[model samples]
Target: MNAVGVDVGGTKIAAGVVTPEGKILDEVRYPTPHSPGTLVETIARAITEVGDAPEVGGVCLAVPGLVLAQENKVVYSPNLRAVEGIPLKDELEPKIGMPLTVENDGNAAAWGEFRFGVGSEADHLVFVTLGTGIGGGVITHGILMRGAQGSGGELGHVTIQATGPRCACGNHGCLEALASGTAIGRRARELAVEHPDSALGRLAARRQILGEDVTELAREGDEVALSVLDEAGRWLGVGLAGFINIFNPEVVAVGGGVMEAEELVLEAARKEVILRARPPSRDLADVKVATLGPKSGVLGAAALARDASSREYLLGG
Candidate 1:
């Protein structure tokens, strides 16, 4: 069986036709639209472009922000303003002529990784995507834990500092406020202005200093850039340490574009987790980079769709 998975991001929408075994048969990407209405149209167009495969049993979307899965509504998305409060599944299911499932992008990525990537063999794990923001999902006893409100694993919003920078969630010192791609970029830009002779400053002068730019500069042995990532990683570790103490999962997978920095981020996070997390919990869980890379979200969404389709087919038979 096959299904369509759409990963909706702030700047791009990636869709893929995937098989039951987690193979992506085909894929396409398009720039995200600014209009809410057009955004829906763009998603439909993405599905169409990917091919209307007869084997496709359903369609699934991995959307950012607080997703009310049962209602098929995106309660809020900081990056994509237009999707907030929209009944995305209701809007797209009919147009695409398929049953649909909606999930939080973070949860979808975690699910993808758990079923097909690094945590495939683990019965308990946590998945964190350190991208534009820190999105996370938790799984325990072979079940995805969505709290009473269906927003249980929002690890990014967990407060790491009582008086740090502001977060998109309107809170201060959340993990995302300190460790996300946006936070790294913001800090790098500030350091650039402060230390005009630094490599980060030089790159800022040439153009905008995005989080990836900082990581690239750090790779070249730039002091300011290196420090920026180090700080971000330390904060990431601090946040994970808390999670370790709380959930004590067997494994934790960290993925997203920013993780390309590898050692610079993981090393610091590991060091901090060791320093902060309680003994056995810290020792029990291993924090590793996600193997699925950037495709986790779409792949996870596809997995969900395929599973649901399989259940329906079995019931009908």
Candidate 2:
């Protein structure tokens, strides 16, 4: 049997029919709607489109928000404002005519990595997705640690610098503010303005200098761009070092669109982790790039639905 996975992101919503072993059988994507009700309908549409298989057992949604899992509600989502305080599962299940599971997007990605990606063999792992903002998921003894209210894995909001720049979360010096894609873009713009004659500056003058632009320019040996990435990488390393000392996970997988630069970021993070992470724990876990790529969120959601179905079946529901 297959399960349906829906990844509701800030800019887009994606869905896929996933085999039990994590293979995606089919997938579809749509632009995210701005209205709460419309977004829910869009998600349902995506689910229906991808989960057309006769054997699909259940559906799961990976939401980018502070999901109140027990209530199937989205308490808050800075990126997707429409979902705020919405009873998503309640609204969608009847429309879709299936059992539903709701989970935090970071947790979903982590679950995907735990079950089928880079951390498949690890008993303890941490997964961080660094994009427009940072998202986090943690697994210990093969079980997700959602805390009492399902808000446990918010690693991006963790403070890396006490007096650094302000984060979108309204906090000062969060890991997200320092190392996320937004942060990279912001820094690149700043550097470009400071050095108007440089490559980054010339590029910024032509159009908006995005995080991808910074990375590309760095790869082409632009000094200003390299400096921005290096700064972001160091902050990422600091955050990873903190996670290493605290959780002591066996593996840590980092992913997200910003990671397109790959070794440009991970190499710096590893170097800093080696410098700051506590002794044996530092040596215990190997931080690696997430191999699942963009499919992690949907696959994880599918895994969530699959697990829910198995539990219901075992209980004779």
Candidate 3:
């Protein structure tokens, strides 16, 4: 069966019709509006634009927020506050002419990887995206492990250092505060000030140091930039090691913009995983890059939509 998935972000909205095999049939994109009404209208329009599949069973919205999946609502979204507290299913179903569901963008993306990307062969998988903030999901025994309120698998918020940097979520020492793109930038700026003679320091003196800039400087053989990435990666691995012990996933797939640094960061993370993660689990878990990249949200949400439809039909039958 075909389904439609909408990946709604702070900047843009991407909607696509997808088949069971994970091919996108039709797709549309729109700049996301900040107001509640316009956000709803934009999402509805995007869905309608791409939902022409003759047998689209359902639609799922991949939203960046604390989603109440049972209610098909987003309770809170830090980056895209426009989506919060909205009756998404009630509003979207009427406009798009189909049943709709909602999910955390991270969870939806993890499902996409499990279904079609790196975790295709694994029954247990852990997927994390390192962007402005860290977000992640877990699939264990072929099941997406949403907690009691459908807010589980929040890997980014896990605390690594008790007295470390503050997170946007108001926590101290969260993995997001140490290993995300935002964290990388913040750390790079600090390092640039400390080492004002290096290439990173030279650039930071001229303009604000962004995460991509750190990666570029590292590629050009700047020791200071390389150190910043290594620090973040080690922090990430510290968090991942705990997850490895708890979930024992066969694969740990990392994605998002920060991954552009690739091995520059992952190499350090792998070393920490080896040092901290217990034997057998550490040896068994394969830390690698996610293949779906940015499209994971749309594809995963579509797959979840199909899964939801199948369940409903079976129940009705």
Model 2, residue 223: distance off in Å is 1.7
Q: What is the C-alpha RMSD of each candidate to the true structure, in Å?
A: 2.8, 2.4, 2.1
Cα lDDT computed for each candidate against the true fold: 0.88, 0.91, 0.93
Best by TM-score: 3
In candidate 2, stretches whose alpha carbon ends up further than 4 angstroms from where it belongs are 311-317
Q: What local lDDT score does residue 184 receive in model 3, on the 0 to 100 scale?
A: 99
Tens-digit lDDT string for candidate 1 (1-317): 78888999999999999887899999999999989999999999998777477688788899888888778888888889998887877888788888888888898888889878998889788999998889989877766777876667899999999999999999999999999999999999999999889998988888998999998999999999999999999999999998889888889899988899988999999999999999898999899999999899989889878765565423421
Better of 2 and 3 by lDDT: 3
TM-score of each candidate structure, all chains considered together: 0.92, 0.96, 0.97
Full ranking by TM-score: 3, 2, 1
**Top lDDT model:** 3
Q: Residue 16, candidate 1: how far off, in angstroms?
A: 1.0
Residues 50-144 of candidate 3: C-alpha lDDT, one tens digit per residue: 88768887999999978887898888799999889999999888888888999999999999999899999998999999999999999988889
In candidate 1, position 88 carries an lDDT of 77
lDDT of model 3 at residue 214?
93
Displacement of the residue 315 alpha carbon in candidate 3, Å: 13
